[model samples]
Target chain A: MSENLIPLEQLQKTCLYDSHVALGAKMSPFAGFMMPIQYDSITVEHNAVRQKVGMFDVSHMGEIFVKGPEAEAFINHIFTNDIRGYEPGKVLYGMMCYPDGGTVDDLLVYREYLANHFLLVVNAANIDKDFDWIQEHAKGFDCKLDNASPRIGQIALQGPEAEKTIIEVLGYKEAADLGFYTFCDVEYNGERLILSRTGYTGEDGFELYTTNENIVEIWDKFLKAGVQPCGLGCRDTLRFEAGLPLYGDELSPEISPVMAGLGMFCKYEKDFIGKETLLDQKAGNLEKKLVGIEIEDKAIPRAGYPVETPEGEEVGVVTTGYHSISLDKSICFALVKKEYSALDTPLCIRIRKKVFPGKVVKKRFYQTNYKK
Target chain B: MSKILDELKYSESHEWVKVEGNIAYVGVTDFAQKEMGDITYVDMPEEGDDVLAGEEFGALESVKASSELISPVSGTVVLVNAELEDAPEKVNEDAYGAWIIKVEMSMPSELDKLMDAAAYKKMIGE
Candidate 1:
């Protein structure tokens, strides 16, 4: 069920590990954790999140807390998004880039507690590296940094019926009032729970974060409520269909936000790291650009497959490709040269000695149903 | 547990062979089809092509990944399953029924080395 064959003892398990096992989930290593890839089938799970509702054990995601008088300034210095005037309950999505304009990580910043406090949710695999990187840049800041990932657990209840499920099953009354990308702190069993109308699946949903002790019970209630148990496999498909970027695939150290067409999220008026480089990129100084392509045939284009022009000259490689479950067509994200990045541009993807024709299209392959 | 047919012979690479006279019908076993979810495409060798035993003759593309389809018995391809060219999901529906190719065996004696239904089941830990 796993690829790398890491020592079983070394793989970390989530709070709902036993529950996943008992449900006969196909477990695989993901971000150093024994994560469920699927419970029944990838097709079934992917359709559930797109058509109905599904829940993901997103506990492996990193949660870092920043506090102190210098919190806002320090975060603004490192973050691409300007959070200086952010309201306490506001949430912002952006990236932390290196000085050379390479991506460090894309993250979400949530301000909920006080004027000087914020929660940074990051990818699980980069927890240690991100913490150290943030700490290194935080040498002169007076803010206190806490890597609270090990103590926190999260669940993303997603679909059109998310609010109803959260109300009827989990009984979180605040879900009905929360706006997209916004969260409210709720007290459950004397423990603070952060419930937000945020999701990666491009659906109307809510993400709840709480202590590890509270997560298992919350998961049980969802399980008993018959919420479809989704895994990382479908989570990927749903997010891909939504045009949401995955860190490792879409954004990496070499693939900057501007290159990935995410420059809109980067506020350039501030003095953040990599601001100058990104600004230069925005002014037509970029080379390879990420674009969406639709394959004209049944051949599936996969990552690392060379994308070529009509003359067979290699342009770039596929970053992520799939037979989109919702659209019922073959589409992929590729980083091709600027000349071939425009819509309706013709490109070819070579899969195992066979070159398939494709055309560039909008990145958002499926219409999202996010509740405003 | 995966299904096993008494009339079919199996290879360790998870392919099944149904012999009819000198022709061997080749397809992926139930275990292989189930493990590879949602077959999307099937790359097959053209008719009259020589297929070597234990060599990759084609590929099975699924939603998750593309897996190589190894030939269990070496022979010249008699016919390619044209139906799978557009309807690859037939394998997911019925692995044994969805024969990928029919080969006129160059070495029909090679069938003696393959495992029957009982031995194949034991080998797959069914």
Candidate 2:
């Protein structure tokens, strides 16, 4: 069967799916679910989050809970980050790697306020794979793992005015007290809710994780408050412009963290899966480096396009590219050979039959507004 | 629902052709542009490049997807719309107004093979 002919019954729906349809959003398939691609123009929705506030129905994300006395040790064993001695309410971003130095998934590890407990928020597309990978490593550990994806729903309120919206619009006074990368569990409408000061967009924002039953009410509340509802369209451009990596594109089984320029997240002092290989790559010549390429032309470089030297020698491929709505320049994240990954190095991108001249530059095309 | 102009002829691939004497003005229809959203780039052939009926001559790229611009008539490209280089969104603003290329027809008979606005409307289930 053709990939586009996947039966409508085969796709899944979030708790707020009806709300999205009612808003006249353009629906498209994403991660085996019928997701909203856009409501208004992507550029319009993008500017809303950058300047004021916008909300997203990110209920498609996966959540897993780890409990028991050995939870911390279990996490550190599979994860690349050194999460030791971290205080409760802290959320750290890292990845799980295979024994061969391949990435399983990049996720956020939240240290729950409860003792010996943690919450793992993973990408929507990798939910099943990530759950199975974590279970496989849970062989002899004294930790209990639970995939809580089906029961959970998430909403991200993002922008400079996010906190104000939560405080004034939603009447959540405690939201103003949360710091970046910190979360607090509170009760809302007689139900349990977890509010975290974390977001995929580089903007300052809050992610509200609650029961599937309660999320519908929260989404409707935001709608009543007149907050712009953002779809996955702008969500991607925002994160890409902020230099954040998407799992399948930037980091995959073949594209290791070392090659993706994410060595900072992998601590050499820690003993974890794929640490030795990452250490070797750190001390040696990496096969490829993820760098930013900017073209003077309006032609956009997309994924799978070839990156070449000025003399027309193939160097690498673009993982993600866009005619940056914020910067008004055509920029892309390309995985080029290590020799050609330096700043101001001249390169060319083969977009279709034509080649556009460009140069390697910093990957952060748009500066993040995260609260430090 | 996409607007279908009464006079322009359309190809199965959604390109519309407006003929004046030996010259043919070619561009994507309103339906095509509406589906493509905001067009960021238009890749077109140089002036004087020959184009054949039902053959690809250029492409239109949006943020999420790319669509090929198929020619509906056989001709030599007389002019390429240079305005789209900076304002590709003009295609989305007015698909009929943003003519991507103009071709001096070498085989005017190919124009008869294209569907009139009524047939194209029925083809798109209007």
Candidate 3:
């Protein structure tokens, strides 16, 4: 059977299933894995990581290996980032786009040591399609791109106390000084792997990249050293709090970079796909703009819900929302009309049958701890 | 594995109905609360609102998702547990004690359709 048509009932499993169960994680289906949504209360787990230390099993993210002579030019053509400036051990946050300027996937491009090869970490759901897309785009370039997602495991150690936890566990001195977006290859149990100061949560953290064979052992060590196991429930809340957009929500084939407020990542100097259309959209009035909202009422603004002004005029729709622990208020991201995008502009959300009052707020609902 | 009091009746949706004269106290069974993790918000019916039997009166929102609070015995809502407005997690902590709403029954015979504690457990595969 084709991968996309596989029934939801025939879902795949992650490597940490048994460990999550042992830690009392509330397991649920997310992006096709029976992953942990939370161990304790979602608020408690969320606050714990924001204040102290927490670790997440993010192995579900897809990682692809792109190498060979034409790797540099080929990757630069597909991604929005200018890859020429990237040095060995440096990583770049970029989005892969279709010829029409629609986002295929947002990914982290890691430059490997002493080579033009790059490691592209992508969203799990878009693995197969992304691989095919890259292969199709490799027309005249003498480059080899391989799907290495299934063979790798990724663990994120995040939060304010992340540095302390890392030093204590691995005895790696000066690891904290490795600036954001920089990584180093280190030996773990005699196995060489990469450790990058990167995370989804808006906190000081490091992501351990290793082969699938060594993942279980590394996870066990982290657990033994008291890394609180976090799940997807808090993961969603944390990213929302940080004002990070989910792929299916803030990005899709229908939305352009200008409307999504991610035009800064698009390089104007480069001749790549979809430049003309994006430039046109950027030059004109944006029909919809992503804005952060805070609900004064008890209603939670979920996706596909209609957003309206207090006068009951249809403005836009909510992309994602829930009871945000960091804000201590109901928060949501909505793509509203430019007129209603100003900060503190009052609006109303239609959740189910009830209409609740809300206001547009500045992005980053909670202060992020990303290294400056 | 909880002690189900006989006076309370249960619904297939795992809500409990405690009858006191023509009024009934409605809450979720311990089994239901355990399944819905960390209740964040309880959308309860307001006073004077008429509810139908086996219909959704309100919903209990959890950190992950929301589940409907189905009425076992329909009636006019006399009062909602005001305490839940401030501490919705109380439902997850103690389901039976944290009755979501109280209703004045329009048809008292609606209680007859519910299952007692023993039958409710059997329905839950307990």
Task: Please report the candidate that would top lDDT against the real structure.
Answer: 2
Q: What residue runs in model 2 are displaced by over 4 Å at the alpha carbon?
A: A1-6
Q: Regarding TM-score, does 1 or 3 come out ahead?
A: 1
Q: Per-residue CA lDDT of candidate 2, range B55-99, in tens?
A: 899899888778888999898999999999878989999999999
Global lDDT of each candidate: 0.90, 0.91, 0.83
Model 3, runs deviating above 4 Å: A1-10
Candidate 1 i-RMS = 1.2
Candidate 1 chain B least-lDDT 10 residues: B61-70
Q: Can you write out model 1's per-residue Cα lDDT over A180-295, one digit (the tens) per residue?
A: 98899987789999998899998899999999889989899988988999999889888988898998889999999999999988998789999999999889899989999998
Worst 10 residues of 3 chain A by lDDT: A1-10
lDDT digits (tens) for residues A1-372 of candidate 2: 132576888988999899999999999888878899999989888999999999999999999999999999999999898788889999999899987778999999999989999999999888999999999998899999999998999999999999999888768888888889998988877888998999978899999999988899988988898889999999999999999999989999987888888988998777899988888888865788899999978888999999999999999999999989899899999999999999999999998878999999899889999877
RMSD (Cα, Å) of model 1: 1.9
CA lDDT of A187 in candidate 3? 80
Q: For this target, which candidate reaches the highest DockQ against the unseen true structure?
A: 2
Candidate 1 chain A has its poorest 10 consecutive residues by lDDT at A1-10
lDDT of 2: 0.91
Whichever of 2 and 3 has more TM-score, that candidate is: 2
Residues A192-226, candidate 3: write the lDDT tens digits: 67889988888888888888667788788888998
Instruction: Evaluate candidate 2 and give its CAPRI docking class based on DockQ.
Output: medium
TM-score, ranked from best to worst: 2, 1, 3
Candidate 3 is graded, for docking, as medium
**Highest TM-score among the candidates is held by which one?**
2
